[model samples]
Target: MAQCVTAFKSMLQARLLEEKLASLYRAGGRIVGGVYIGKGQEAFSAGLAVHLEKGKDVYGPLIRDQAGRLAFGEPLLDTFRTYLGVITGPMRGRDGNVHRGRPREGMPAMISHLGSLLSVVNGMLFARRLQGRLGDSVGATSLGEGGTSTGAFHEALNQAAIEKLPVIIAIANNQFSYSTPNSRQFACGDLLDRARGYGVQGYAVDGTDLTACVSVFSEAVKRARAGGGPQLVVGSLLRLSGHGEHDDSSYIPDQVKSSPLGQDCLPYAESQLKASDLITDEEVRKWKDEFLMEIDAALAQASKEPTPDPFRENWRALSTAGLVEGQFEA
Candidate 1:
């Protein structure tokens, strides 16, 4: 009961923060890039990641994954610092967006290329096994439904299954790949079917139902950790916001956009919490209010930090210093 409450609170905080960031981006705040939000998909991230070992099991999160990052122990201030490009933040004023991550916290930095993540995560899992560190350890990575069609995704999943690597591949089947709906993406009966075809354990869940998401994801994670080989969990949700703050999601059908399932994850989670007698309406309200206030303060403090100047910091990123100085040319 206590763990459920804590997980719900973390998911709530991440959802509120994503909404706040969207508001700031629309108001012309100093967000250096697109603000991708995980508004309706918080449960999959928080639930799947909260139980993993902090520094042992690495998980790569996509742009729309604030909840995953927070669940893995990222500081709220660090997230704001990353988005706002604070000079002292994790990325050190480099890429100012969800594309950044802090691996020291068990969260691997995600590349923007969606289909490519599975391959990288597979390699990481293999490396862990080689180092004899695979005792109940698992690595995870995610991609949108559209990503399943990519050749790299196929290669990664097949290889992972063949090697019997401990990895969890989450498919956030949010109905659309940006503006493109599932109909255009593939003709597979479902993503789980595709996963099964890859010769790995596969399951699908209602992404909006917080309890269900957590249960299925937890099962998949446990299976992977037990050397049961790779498992794929596909979560069904909607993209409540635009692909970015700039692109309005008017492309989504009105029927889907207005459905109860299309609503944000908060109400669904609240209903479950209430049904389980885990929380009260008053407590839910308090959590939202407190989280908003906390984010506001964090953002205000982060905004006061100096903006990163590339001239000063870009030099630090140059890995081939000796080669650049012509010392290695000969």
Candidate 2:
């Protein structure tokens, strides 16, 4: 019950923050890059992240994973800083807003290529195993169903299976890959089939159901940590908004939008929490108010911070002087 409440709170906070980001982007001069929000997918994203142990477990969140990032211990201020291009953000304002991460803290800075994050997490877990520091620590990464079609996803899953690494590959089957539908992406009957083909344990859940997401993800994490090799969890839902703030998502049909999977998870999650006696309407309202204030303060502070000054910045690929040229080859 406590875990559910916490996850719900993270989802709520993420929704609020993303809404603010979208507004800022619409205002025409705030954000540096695209604004991507995990609208209908927050429950699934937060569910997996809430089970991860910060500093012990690793997570690589995708572009639409603000909820997961927060549940995995990312600061709310950092989101604003990154989007506003404040130099003090995790990316030091050098990268896109969605690409911010702290590698030393187990979250790798994201690359825009689809399916690439799985390999990155696999490498991190493999490195830890080689160092004899793995010790039941699991690494997890999230991607869309479309990413599953990439070669990187196949190679990483195969590597993890061969190595028996403890990892979770979360797939948000949101029905469409941007404007493209699933029918065009793969011929498999279900995504779980891909897991079976890879010889990894697989689970399916309703992405719109917060309780179901939490339950399934908890079990998946447990299995992975217990030496069950990689776990693939595919959650079915719909992307409630456009791919980014720029696109209007007119490509999505009305019948599809009205489907049960298309329903927004946020309200459903709140209702579940209330009915379970874990939270009340008053409490939910209070949380929203508090989150709004925090977001306002974060944005205000980040807006006043200076962006990176190119004149004072080091543009070299290697920042350390000792690593230069042939001096270190010996």
Identify the candidate with maximal lDDT. 2
Root-mean-square deviation of every model: 2.1, 2.0
Regions of model 1 farther than 4 Å from truth: 314-320, 326-330
lDDT of 2 by residue, 244-321 (tens): 999899999999999998989999999998999999989999999999999999999989999999997766568675
Worst 10 residues of 1 by lDDT: 321-330
Clashing pairs in 1: none
Which stretches in model 2 have alpha-carbon errors above 4 Å? 322-330
